[model samples]
Target: MIGKHLFSVEAKHEFVRLPHFGPFLTATAAGQAVDSLLARFDGLSIRMHVLASNQPDGVEAKEQECAYQLECACSEKSPLSVVEPLARAGDLPCAEEALRIANDHGVKACEIGYLKVDEGFLLLHVHMVTADLQKAMTATRWRRRELLGRPEKGEVVIMTTPIPMLANS
Candidate 1:
């Protein structure tokens, strides 16, 4: 069993409320926000969530405040691996393959980023919710049975965040 201490890197980002249309973060501003965050926390695995608002129906709220929350963490001793970036247009196959490889190796978590430079956003896909390190360790152990020759296939939980492409990139 992997030690829980191996995944103890907790540096989370505060929620950033920006104008958004519907529940999607497809706007250029959303992309910029994500890019800025990635730059601020270099080398750390960042997971972002689009927080839902509780506004009343038909309120006609202009400049609706949409909170983009980010959860970031990383550790040198962690076993989690980030798959290579793939094109956004056709990344399903690549993501599936990555998940398969992770399951085969008994990896409890996986990260896959889709580069959509033309669309101005980088789609980040993670196999777990919240960057909680302890949960990862527990899940890993539960999946890796001692009596069983091989670990059971871990759940493929996908959490995605769209990061904006840098101006130079």
Candidate 2:
């Protein structure tokens, strides 16, 4: 299941500042940055959401609220260089391509983030309406491979639901 606590205090601030640093080229780079935040802050809560740059205005508004709800304290921004090597390796799809595929598959938004607090395995949370669940799941499966590059055996968790439905749950 997707954790209700998606971001640590530090991670929230980092995400809020990510845009100023520049666009993350790939999900792997973003994930690596998230991992770094967790390590640096001893963050127990962390999550990564992948959404299209051109989302509808309504969706964008809700996302801003969501970010606010997940706020935390940290001023240092993660350097893009930490993850640039993996991003330049060319093994994963660029953020734009991944977002395009997800949008085409009816995924309103998706998240790749840490799962168990102690285990440190990754979890993928796919958000979409019930009508789009199937296609969204397929897109999420593709994303799993892209983000994790063969996730550790028995360490994968996939969760799905509409974002509104997840707000209080």
For each candidate, the alpha-carbon lDDT, in order, equals: 0.35, 0.33
Q: RMSD for each model, in Å, please? A: 17.0, 17.7
Model 1 score (lDDT): 0.35
How well does candidate 1 match the true structure in TM-score terms? 0.21
Clashing pairs in 1: none
Q: Cα deviation in Å at residue 2, candidate 2? A: 27
Candidate 2 structure lDDT: 0.33
Question: Which lDDT tens digits does candidate 1 get at residues 53-156?
Answer: 44434322322323323322122232332222232443333445556644544443244443455555343333333344346444434433432563433332
Best by TM-score: 2
In the predicted model 2, the residue pairs found to clash are 9-72
Worst-scoring 10-residue span by lDDT in model 2: 78-87
TM-score of each: 0.21, 0.22
Clashes of each: 0, 1
